[model samples]
Target: MFTTKDATTPHVGLLVDKVEDNVDYKKEDIKPLDKLTEVGFDIDPQTKNMMRGLIKLAEKHSVLIDPSAIFSPVHIAQEDIQESEAYGLF
Candidate 1:
């Protein structure tokens, strides 16, 4: 979620829900989602564009059906955990 090459602030940060406390961040402890939303991210514009493209593809293919509905903080974590366990993302 971050890189030394990150611009403006070579730091990667995120705001998560209270359940975020249950996750292993590998470094910093979890912070509330409101914090993350407020702190936000400063990813490279190129990466943002690339992500937009990928999101578009997913939306068009129904790969992320009702994505907004599943966008709940808890579900986001679940999706990541599932994908990691399923494909050894950990």
Candidate 2:
């Protein structure tokens, strides 16, 4: 997942499995996951810090998991997003 500040609201972006035209296209030829925002996980400051620690530990041990498994799309409040942005955290 990735975060973007381009929009007026703060939201998370997710990378989904690749969709095939024959199998996954919607009525207008849009992919199933395209522009979809079903749920969100809010990452508070403490949680973010904890996650950072966990990542550090994993790196130290050389057991870091794949990035794709780490997080889902999260929708944080504007203020929190701003704070996170200030720290260049994602």
**lDDT of model 2 at position 61:** 18
Candidate 2's TM-score reads 0.17
Against the hidden true structure, what lDDT does model 1 obtain?
0.30
Worst 10 residues of 2 by lDDT: 53-62
Each candidate structure's TM-score, on Cα atoms with residue i matched to residue i, is 0.17, 0.17
- Candidate 2 on 1-90: residue-level lDDT in tens? 445455455444434444322332224433222122233545454234323211112223111122322332245322243223333333
* After superposition, candidate 2 runs with Cα above 4 Å error: 1-10, 24-90
RMSD of each: 15.9, 16.5
Per-residue lDDT of 1-90 in model 1, one digit per residue for the tens?
333333556543323222221322322232323342254645454333223111112223111122222223433544644333433321
TM-score of 1: 0.17
Top candidate (lDDT)? 2
